[model samples]
Target: MPREIQKAYKNQTRSVDGKPGKKYWQNSVDYKINVKVFPETRIVEGSEIVNFINNSPDELSEIVIRLYYDVFKKGNKRDSRVNPKDIGEGVELKTIIVDGVNYDLANSDKIKRYGTNLTIRLREPLKSGQDLKIEFEWQQKVTLTLDRTGAKDDTSFFVGYWYPQVSVYDDIFGWDRLDYTLDTEFYNNLSNFDVNITVPDNFLVWATGTLENGEKVLPNNIYKKFLKAKESKEVIEVVNEKDLEGLKLKHNTWNFTAKEVTDFAFAMSDHYLWHAASVNVAGKDVLINSAFPKGKAEKHKKLTSIQQKVMKHFSEDVPGIPYPYPVFSTFIGLRYSGSGMEFPMMANNGGSGVPVTVHELFHMYFPMYVRINERRFAWMDEGWADFMENLVIHKFFNEDKSNSFYSRFKLVTQGTLGTIGDLPTVTSSQYTGDSYGYQAYSLPSLTYALLYQYLGEEKFFKCFNSYVKRWAKKSPTPYDFFNTFENVSGEDLSFFWEPWYFEMGYPDVGIKSFEEGKLIVEKVGYKPIPISIDVVYKNSKKSYSKIIDLSVWKNDNRTYAIPVPNHDQVESIVLNSDFPDFNETDNFFPPLKDSYEEKGVKSSIVGNYYVEDYNIELSIAKENEALVIYSNSWVWLNTILIPKDSVNFNTSDKTGVLKYLEDVSGRDEIELEYPKYNLKLKGIKK
Candidate 1:
């Protein structure tokens, strides 16, 4: 265990048995905010009243506030490039009142400012189990950069990270002072919010929580339909283009209230189509909504229905947990057409199709409900969401293997593993740079899916549901997750965890030999992966796949033998599956040369070929009077191939030999042999 985790145990904030310690506490703040938005000017002005409860045992001499929009401020450090048009003065503070004491803004001794964090020294030390009140007024120009929160156009905006809020004071990390670098996301406390947003009279708002006064702000007929859709299972067009055009402008304030949520966000648009539906999850009706521009209505018409199915599947099938929120909305006007960002009860979507919708909705369970700390361990949430999204796509949506999640997972895993920028799952997400997507999403998701396969559906979900239930509404470290699964499953999964989570390696297994009713498979890579083999029979001309679970490698055995039924009738054995493999060229047995021995070389062998086992590229051709072979792998360069006969070939040196093979695609292939080096490499003509 790391020293930090050991310290957390000694501090009594977390237990070693995968549960919260007796003295575990998380600080929270209740916010009352009033904000006004000007669409034409793209300005947002807000004032907030914060009631912070110090639930931790340590006295707080100082407090930290996160200003997320400071990434747009000129000269601030940023992880990635931002739109130049959005660069401006970040948040302008107008007034600050702490416990009714006025503070001077220009006094350097009272406050210190970092790139995106503000540290304020308190006048008096706040004792344990005490509380304080703070008030602030600020204004910021809404950015057009189309980040997680930004304006899609002059009249459409998805606003997040707009308010200056108190940072999380947790049991493990005291103050989450991580900068908002547009790289890592956020870590926040579950707090209560009562916000009143004042927008143009014609614009409509879709926010993070249930609208407390929807009847007062919305049209009378539309308000009735919104209420009716909450109880009905049918999808209703609550605010269509016609309703948006016909509504009279009267009230401008939209009131919203959300209790025990991580953060708040809202989207406003003058013209957008809204669809609504409801589904009963654990005896609670969850209102599902989708809003998009009229131009995207045709593409997003079935979004609410899809969300209904996802809600039901996620609640009843996978995690077996109830939906936590009463209302959920997806606003479809993000900058790009395929990006999506998740909040507590809302999503800023890019109007992509079903997969993005399902992927973003799955986040509601991981980081949102379970409160996974995205600033450090993003894979904890992103990996699970991607895994569940792919699982639902295959099981519920009936997508084919080509379009299935596993296909993409295999492709990406194979491409990324052992590459230059590849890192383990335990690495901090903010440091992974170009490989962040692979580390946070593909690799871990593949690991989870493989774990599911190894544990089977019943045992897998039993442990999975336990982890979710234990960490719901709380922050959990990676050790907490690792320990919970081990505790629930009653198994020490160090063998599985060490290689995939903490180590650097990829999975590569290949066919060694098949003889005497037994097949020997070799583990060429460091990571342990399940073996999937397909056996083709010559007599029956049929094939069946034999699956070996990942537990076969529990002992770190390099080779395993499988008893093949009717081995005498087996014509070819191939190591093939949806799982990732680094080198697939040698997966086919019987050495393509043996099958084509009866027929003479049908195609020319003068071309380049790749030998994956040696990581070598071989250029072979008839150079002058000798068949010269040039290799750029390992230590050797060139070798001479002399014709032994019309149909056979051998090198000038007696130790080297070669034979012809016909590829499945009718390309000419060869098996090059070096007896002195004990090397037999299969090379396909490219």
Candidate 2:
């Protein structure tokens, strides 16, 4: 542990018992916001009241607010590269009020806005356990650029990062003062919201919370269909294109309320179709919703069905918790992010694949439920999601597809068969520079999977669910997560977490030598992973596979010898893990080589021959020069027939060794190993 972490533990921000400290605290906020969007003008106007409670022990000096729309602020710093044409005029602040007092409209030294974050120095210090009400009225233009959140076409808009939120203040970091470079993900204090959005009457608003007043806003027939669709076993068409006939009302307000959420986001469009259905997960009937352009809805009609199945899988099979939120929604905003972005109870998506739907829905479990700090540790969220993705595939698809996908992850990650520049999961996501997906998504997920294999499914699930339950709705750092796993599993996982999470190398273990009834193995890489090997006996010729625990690596054993029973004549030995071996050349150990050979014909060395310790290339010769040749290897010898002319086989004509072997006896197999350093391999006659 680092000095800061130990200090935190001593300070009671975290506990030595692998749980959040008794004195741990987090601030809470309540938002009452009303926003009006002018889609034609590509602008949004909002007025909001934030009721913030200071739950910490310290007195506050300044409050940092994240005005996400200011990312488009001219000359703002960005972690992700974007085209200049995509930038907009930035957010405009029209009015600012603190605790019912109106400050100077233009030049208040207390108010400072830099980049996307605004820091306001308080005139009256907010005491501990006090509530402060801050108000703001602002407008910002939507950009032409498409990202996780933004406007899509002339008809659709996926609005996110549109409001100002108070940065998280925790025991570790006083305030998360980091700017929005869009590299690291977001971490916000759990908040409650009562929001109202007003748009053109033709537009259909699909948002974060349950639609509380659908009867007042939606068309009468559409409202009836929505109610019917709530419990419908299949998808119900709420509002199709034909429902756009009447044009009496000009505008309407849609009200929504959400409790105990990390953040809130919504999408609205003037020309999208609406679909809804419900499913029973965790003894709760959660509504599943979808909205998309009429042109694409036919192709994506089963989205609601996938959502229902995924919800049930996550609730009962894995984490074993019922769905937490009341409503789950999936809205279409294609060409925006090419994937879905998950909020508290909704997902903004551009996917038609089953894996994508399941993967995004799994997000609702990790950072949303467990509330891991993603900006610093994205692997905590992305890793868990990728791990669950394969599980879902196995259950819904097939075991073969799941296995194939699992291998694909291994190959792309550090476990690849060749040297790859990889980083540890403990490294910050923003500082990963490149290879972000492999670091955040593949490597960390592989850790959990390997952990699953280390501890069987029963123990693994118990420990994992314990961590989720303990940290629900709370912020946990990387140390807290690792400690919880060790505390729950009753295993010292530093040996595992050290090499897999805190360091950057992959595991490379192979058999060194096999003799008598013993097999010696060598650890070629820095990583000493748990071993699995298959041993063969010459007498029985049957292979026996066994997995060894990782405790053997505790003594720093470079070469580990495993004693085999009934082992006078050991046939061969091979190594394997659940993942893969980057190199297979050293994977096998042998007593397996035989020193003798069978009689066979040998040519005058038609291919390249060895002479005077040098390789000599030769051209094709006559028919007699090409003779039948048989060659192979073993601990002593496998089998071969040596002929009379083969040994002293016209060494005068063959001046050099064979550089490349084409074929022998109509077979492309040539096996030979040099006893000392140099030896000649004879080529067969044509």
Candidate 3:
């Protein structure tokens, strides 16, 4: 554990309600951005003039603009403390050229340079429905961070946050005050963007929004060829002919326009090998473009398939809500900064493989279109993206892949849930101090998994669709999403979100004991919503499950002894064996000793049922006044005791024996004296 984690855990406190604190939805904002990219110079310059149409009933003063550049160039000293290359060539704010001229507003004084974020304060007090125009020319040489932008080697440029961009203004953080922590994600308002990019003629430009000057920007003859290709829906190749010498001298530029976009990014590459596929996403004829090097053509194809599947899933899952774009481009490149990132119609994904592509593609529906402020409520975007990605992967590749993502996600959620001190969900900024890998990506992904488990697949999907429809093209706070889901599902989700977000705690459950056709399970520590248990009986036989809701209890420790109606017909019980539970290390069954004692009776005991590692042992102990069997690890065990008079017990009536034991136990402690029995079990470390 990191020192920070240990400190947080040691100082952690509990809320009065024993639930995570409440997170209210902040005020929403909408924006329209127009940008232009110079691909050859690797520069993306744009302006976002926002109308502060405050939907909230409160009057607000000045707004703060977050340009992620401050995190890299704080104090203008060029700190080499963090990732050296992330500062890249080092970012510099050339000028705050508003409406083409330098405008120093009163709020501009607060424009302190942070690590990678440039905080520009608004000049005047803007009331609801008021508008402001601000522009700045900033450039980044592009370095590699966890997910934002930079170059992998010198061959590729992962261009994102590679420019001085606007920050988000919401009710929660007011202006998102946290520094650029690696684990935290982003949050921005929805806006329209029109970008005109000028790049080298040899380089192909892939960016957000629609190409405004595709024909005029390309070589005259090549432009004509492209036009013809668009009309004929065929691949148009531009041949290098001696007569086209003049065309080669001119630089080609691709201008794009996009509406209701949260952010803007673009990539330029001369080595790109491009392919386009026309597919119908939600009755809308859209083009899916894949851009990669020649060596990655096969990977691009796989990405296309994943995109197709995601689009299909989105279309079917969210009814009456179609994708609002003419094209969905999936760019695959080695320069990718992270697994994948979402733009308006285009998503830049790492060439890691199909999983990264699928995950990024799903982002188009959440923060990309839903327009949630990602910095404050990253879970809203990342969690939803992860959920959709898992769903699509499962639909295509089956449970194995889905299980892998799910298990990984669970670990993240469990880790975070177990660490954070009791803080209000609204004020609990997990992204603030956390690492980018955990805060920005993994934690949010886990939140989605827990939400899915709590709401089940049907209601959860409905709530998700409702969230998208209600917040599409508009800014929505964490509260807005929670309220929408809760209202639609008619389930109070405060209990679910409180512990998951505000207080970091994971489900650490173990099978306490199993005997007399009954199983007792106890939560060792942490309060997960409901314990999802999977009990397997015989080989190839389907498992039985039960969701143990613990929301009604305040204590962290609770035990439940459920009667097994068919104890005689049972084989073994596994807690959270389905991988739904976030923390599984502490999850096991039939305490080893109890399992071993029952092992000779045509029954098998399993230990570390959830995790691959760990060992199981069986032993005997004395209980009550009778001799009984026990498991070495009482974490998950089952004990069987025989009556003193039944020395010659009939083996023919195993069911009867279990039934009699159940009647005698009746959910209470069974007093028995027993001799010790030893059984050993082991497994390879995972």
TM-score of each: 0.86, 0.80, 0.69
RMSD of each: 9.1, 11.7, 12.4
Count steric clashes of candidate 2: 25
Per-residue lDDT of model 2, residues 193-312, tens digit only:
999999988788888778899988887788889898887867788877677555322338999999888898889887788888888876667888988887777777888888888888
Q: Which ten residues in a row have the lowest lDDT in candidate 1?
A: 399-408
lDDT tens string, model 3, 429-542? 453443334555566665666677667778888887777776666556565566677878887776676766666456566667788877776766554545656565765476
Per-candidate local distance difference test: 0.81, 0.71, 0.52
Query: In model 3, what is the error at residue 496, expressed in angstroms?
Result: 3.4
How many clashing pairs per prediction, in order?
0, 25, 57
Cα deviation at 614, candidate 3, in Å, is 22
**Candidate that beats the other on lDDT, 1 or 2, i.e. the better one:** 1
Cα RMSD for predicted model 3: 12.4
Instruction: Output the number of the lDDT-best candidate.
Output: 1
lDDT of 1: 0.81
Better of 1 and 3 by TM-score: 1
